[model samples]
Target chain A: MQEKIKVTINKKPIEVEQGTTIYKAAKELNIHIPVLCYMNLKDMGIEHNPGGCRMCIVEVEGARNLPPSCVTKCTDGMEIRTNTPRVLNARKTVMELILSDHPFDCLICAKSGTCDLQKMAQDLGIREIPYQGEQSTYREDTSPAIIREIDKCINCRRCETMCNDIQTVGALSGIYRGFEAVVAPAFEQNLEHSPCTYCGQCVAVCPTGALTEVDQTNSVLGALADPRKTVVVQTAPAVRAALGEEFGMKAGTLVTGKMTSALRELGFDYVFDTDFAADLTIMEEGTELLDRLGKHLKGDKDVKLPILTSCCPGWVSFFEHHFPEMKDIPSTARSPQQMFGAIAKNYFAEKIKVKREDMVVVSVMPCVAKKYERSRKEFSVNGDPDVNYSITTRELAHLIKQANIDFHTLDDQDFDQPLGESTGASVIFGTTGGVIEAATRTAYELHTGKKLDKVDFKQLRGMEGIREATVDMDGTQVRIGIAHGLGHARQLLEDIKKGKSQFHAIEIMACPGGCIGGGGQPLHHGNSQILIDRQKALYKEDAGKAIRKSHENPFIQTLYKEYLGEPCGERSHELLHTHYFDRKKRWIKK
Target chain B: MSSVKVELHQKDVDKIKAIAKEHHNEPEELINVLHATQEFFGYLPAEVQEIVGEEMNVSAAKVFGVVTFYSFFTMTPMGRYPISICTGTACYVRGAETVLDEFKRQLNVEVGVTTEDGKFSINCLRCVGACGLAPVVMVGDKTYGRVSPDGVKDIIDEYKDAE
Candidate 1:
């Protein structure tokens, strides 16, 4: 067991584990110290405490100068004064210096209400910036999913840590020094030119307006207002699990009914669920998995055994850039978002007696990368995209507020028929290990020719970065692997590259905790417990459903019977399955 | 945003690979390897750093970061006759700012930039360990002590005439 040490903060004594940060010890005493450069995702095992901003400086007795509490370790009998006049003045001066270089455009900034630096300035009561000087400025970089307004960076290095340490994308790093210092790609290249996967993890961790999601809400509103256009909206499974937090609802609050009502209020002609498409995904992907498994079992030497899940656009981009050699190893099933768009524009539009061009299929996702994914040329035909617009969970919340809908009192409603109906298997796609588990449910039943007594695969579910489990499929021992976060996915891919992996199928979600902790979800503000709660809400939603298997979803059964014909058939491949490309040579700009 | 792009020669790529191999391609020895590359090539360019990144298994952005963090490394090529003006506190007090301004006026270039003609470039150093020679300017290896605004033209003319 770890040793515990006693420390005094503002005259109150507390016991904490040795090597604990002074900030943690002070929190035990109910003393809140404002911090800017410190971010701790304890559950994800990611902590960035650069102590660059000096906003969390506290006076340690017997020390010559105040030390940053976020990075400073506590010793036994250490008396720390967080609110001393000396510490207060120093913090105020440091904040003033930071503000002096920062743009005073919070009224127009995208991150005004949620910016950590703005809140820190308010907490410090900084009325004026006394240390005005030349401020650092850089040209704005607008990518498909994110915007880099680097002039507002406070050099907190939070985005750097997330990009390099957590995601391992390495598209961003701290460059230059002193006043010229900023986070950017090599040669200050634009993100599109860099190896950025457009995961939006950097935007998720940025403490200021330096990084943010590219706002597509205005275009969505324009489409909604168009009289000739029929704008149909689809909400991803993860959006409902966390959208309630944008209002005053608690973290785990399930707002599916209220969300559908709010979308209807926003003038969407029809409100559908991406979970419906997720069910279709399982039908197609599960069949593909079974075919590959059977072929490998028949000693097909050329067959790749462990077929990877390709539902995440960010993960797809990552593999395209980093592991192009294994491009053919993942399943060809299009993501649920794209699958929904294709079906809405083709099948659903035909049923509604509307031309595909006159119909606009918008998606509300808990992922920023979906914006980039929907914009891919492969997903478009003759310049008409399958999905017209992709907005994030945060953007949807903003649209609801802009529409003046009283979300709290909105009546519980249901999704539109056919395209809106989904099963419990589809609802679980919002969290890690969910897609593979959902696939296993159908695959097990289909492969063994027997019904599963319990649909839930508890062994495959957890918060670990990488998990492996063996399932008894009748008599065959089929191994499965689950990985979330691109860094963890890199390890599994490396194992596959070395030909040492022992799994028959693998699932990879680019974001930590899967879509529940997506880059476009409601900001947790450095509290990871919100992610756990969101995961719980998704599981609860799944448990309460009457139909628990994708094959068991009646609407899906009707659709496959009426339209798709059979899973992975020729028509299904045309509409649902897609191909991958080698993007390793794309980043070398001349 | 104006980004600087450089085309590397095959020899330069080979040299970078050699330097990386000297450091055994360890990511932790990135700084040392970068120093050796800068020492051989006079400055670190984007293409050179990209090769080093690939060889050392580090990111090009991180290699650029280390290059820009230290004062000794330069991204652009230095002019044949590089002019460095001391901007130390002692030198600034002794009218070094005026000397720097005069150099900027004559060269038609800002600090850390080369002239369009490629004959001269201007830079500012904190100190050259010659506090006694306050307000000093160095042209290549030769130091000019007590340089005034009037002498700036003479320094440029000396290099221009020599070429």
Candidate 2:
């Protein structure tokens, strides 16, 4: 048994665990303490993440002055007051000061009704600014995953925490002092020039309109209007699970058929499924994994064990920034976004006998990083890149709204044949531990020359940051680990570096909960972790699909037999696989 | 070394020398050495931390975290007359910020920073209750009374030429 600390807040005595933060203790007592920099009930540690934002201040009766409740620990017999007039007045003044430097145009802002700062001001009954000053003038960064409007920042430090502490990317931070303070890359460079993975974790955590996904609706509408281009749209496997929520549906409601119909109503020439490319990815990636395993068994000294899955663009970019040396360990298979883009430009263009340049491939993804992934030069095939424009699931909702399309009344429509057809293995690609589970089913059968007793690896599923499991297949016991979020990724890599991890394969996702809970996903009531209802809905989708395994997808089998011949063929390496260069070598070596 | 002079502690100077020794005699070791020194002290004095960070290829922000996170570090030299103004919530509502403004005007230096003429380093604490004393500003570990805007000049003049 441990000693309990007794603290009195607003005349009510409360007993809490030793070292419990004042903010957390207040929550346990049902005390409403307003916070900007604090997110509670999260699985991660809480030291206010970065403590740069001075928003969580509270008064203690016997103490000398107000302390930030998030950082301050409770002591035995401490007297605290949360709703005192003095604390209330101080908080109001600070909020006023923060808003003074912010932009005044909330009506036109993309974050109009959902911003936390706006909600807090409304709660405090603050309608007008008390002071006037020169707000920092900065042009919007407007990148793939995120848009930077520094003028809207209250310096709540949520973006910084999300980027550095949560994602462990260290791409954004506060530079300079006093009035010159701004969060940005070193020297305030453009995000395109930096090693940002475009995970959009920062955008999701932003309290105001300071950070948001770039609006590509204008470009999409322009392409739709253009007579010269034939616009085709493809949505990823995980997108349907959350798309229904924008129109009063539950978080995990499966809206796949409805979403397809809605796209058709919007005048898209073809509504393809990214799951087609996802199944295609499994074929290419699965083959590559087996080749590497074979090389390792043959005692190839250069063979890489635990070849990390490279399906997630955020994880791929993380490799470029941090572990460039381990780049070869990543499967050469381009993500589903690139796979669809390449085929649309190369194979599909040639088949339809249309000029590749005239075909526009639009990707609707749950990931903001996919937007950035589309812009990279490596994703291009010959003179044309695979993906033309990428939009988040939220942006897709915005598009439907822009067109005045009633999503609820939309009729169910099927995806275009051949490329649109996919398996349950591809459908589960949106959830965490999905890729490993999908690959294991096929790998075990191939290795042992027998069928698997269980298709679902229930042990490996869910949203835990890091999960490990081993299965006995034939004479070989396959060891595997799944890690979500970059902070957990760092731990796994460090463990690997220390020779503590002995695994045949490992799966790493730079963002939490894989693509379904991507940084670009819809923000729901401040609890950004993939809601339980949504996760259940995605698995339900997988359970209902006729074809559960990627290997069993007949279309993928036909694709290999007709065109590619083999997985690691010369043509496969030319198109599907890519290489990486070490960016941090000089920095680490020096 | 030149007319633009800054004074530093002997212990700080010795620690900087030791850091430089580990990084080889390469001149770029200056910034890294200065950051390590600032970790021991409170802040980097003038060219100290900048010189060390540039030498190590580590940016100044990395060096800044060392100074800022650790309560002891300072970028500017400590005031020959150090003044800590308490402008926390209780005092701020009681006009402690106004008192702090007077000190800044009198000493010609902002909070958490120092004056150029070897005179004062002004910093504001989160809180130092003496709410009855309301708006208080401490000068060199000694607490001052309800410091008003009118008393700013007198407080500085007393410390003038004392060093």
Interface RMSD to the true structure, each candidate:
3.6, 9.5
Q: Score the docking of each candidate (DockQ).
A: 0.39, 0.05
Best by lDDT: 1
Task: Output the lDDT of residue A26, model 1.
Answer: 85
Q: Tens digits of per-residue lDDT for model 2 on B53-107? A: 4445444334443444455555556766788878788788888888888877766
DockQ of 2: 0.05
TM-score for all predictions?
Answer: 0.92, 0.79
Task: Estimate the lDDT of model 2.
Answer: 0.77
**Candidate 2 structure quality by residue, lDDT tens digits, A1-590:** 88998998878899998989888898888998888767642654524434445567889977787888888899998888888888888889888888888888989998987789888888888888888978776667877668899888877777777776777776676755576666776435577655577888888778889888877878888888888888889998778989998888878889999999989888888889999888878777877788788788889988888778888888888888777767787787888888888777776777677788888889998888888889887787575668888989989999998889999988888999667888888888888888888888777777778987678888879778899998666777778899988889878887777778788788887777777777767885456444566778778988898888888888778867877678768766776777765654132111
For residue A259, model 1's alpha carbon misses the true position, in angstroms, by 0.9
TM-score of chain A of 1: 0.98
Give the per-residue lDDT digits (tens) of candidate 1, residues A1-590.
99999989998989999999999888877889998889988877888888888989999889998999999999999999999899999999998888889999999998989988998889888898888689888999998888999999989899888888888888999988888888998778899888889888888889999999989999999999899999999999999999999998999899999999999999999999999999999999999999999999999999987999989999999999889999999999999999999999999999999999999999999999999999999999899999989999999999999989999999999999889999999999999999999999999999998989899899999899999999999998999999999999999999999999999999999999999999999899888889889999999999999998999999989988889999999889999999998876332433
